[model samples]
Target: MEEKSWSELLAEHSPELAQISRADGEFLDADSALPAWVKQLMAMQMDAVFNHPHGARWYGRRARELGASREQVVEAIKLLRIFGGRPAMATGAEGLREPSE
Candidate 1:
């Protein structure tokens, strides 16, 4: 099996990807007062619990960029039920636990 770019996947299956991504970005970008790390980490937590592998990874990078600590990211992964998070919870926990320095 081959992997598809988001654009390719959306074109073949989820044509609404752009709109959904835009909407989600708007929601996450809403208030100026909230710290970037907070918003990214919150989104990561949702992605972790929901078992969105690509989305979780995407959130992980964003959270890292915004200064999410390893411990904080782990806490986010722990939000998932065993099955609910699936590959994402496991993968996120493993990846986020890596030493920063």
Candidate 2:
């Protein structure tokens, strides 16, 4: 199955999401009713994608649009760097920079 945005995934599966399906892959719990949970999820996505060379260009705008603040995005990067080390920190930090004018 295609990877869907958290918002799209949530909308596509609301009441059903509350139940844990045996189907494999990353499925968000229906219990993620809190707005922050959704935001944090999106921010963490940046952490994963930031491993790519151009991950910020790939996931930065979408992350914010998905409700992740700049601070949250940066914080997620910092966390990843702490665990993932320098290279992760370097790439992830790029996500925090505002696009050039």
Per-model TM against the reference: 0.50, 0.37
lDDT of each: 0.72, 0.55
- Model 2 over residues 1-101: C-alpha lDDT tens digits? 88886656665778366333322122332224555435445445554655543544445555565576778767766766666677767988999999982
Clashing pairs in 1: none
lDDT of 1 by residue, 1-101 (tens): 89987767765786688678768787675556886767887777677666687778887788777777888777766654444557766777787675873
What's the number of clashes in each of the models?
0, 0
TM-score of 2: 0.37
What lDDT score is found at residue 66 in candidate 2? 54
- For every candidate in turn, the CA RMSD to the true structure comes to 12.0, 12.8
Native-structure RMSD, model 1:
12.0
Off by over 4 Å in 1: 1-4, 7-20, 26-31, 79-101
Residue 34's lDDT in candidate 1: 80
Q: Assess the local accuracy of residue 79 in candidate 1 as a C-alpha lDDT between 0 and 100.
A: 56
* Candidate 2 clashes between residue pairs 3 or more apart in a chain or in different chains: none
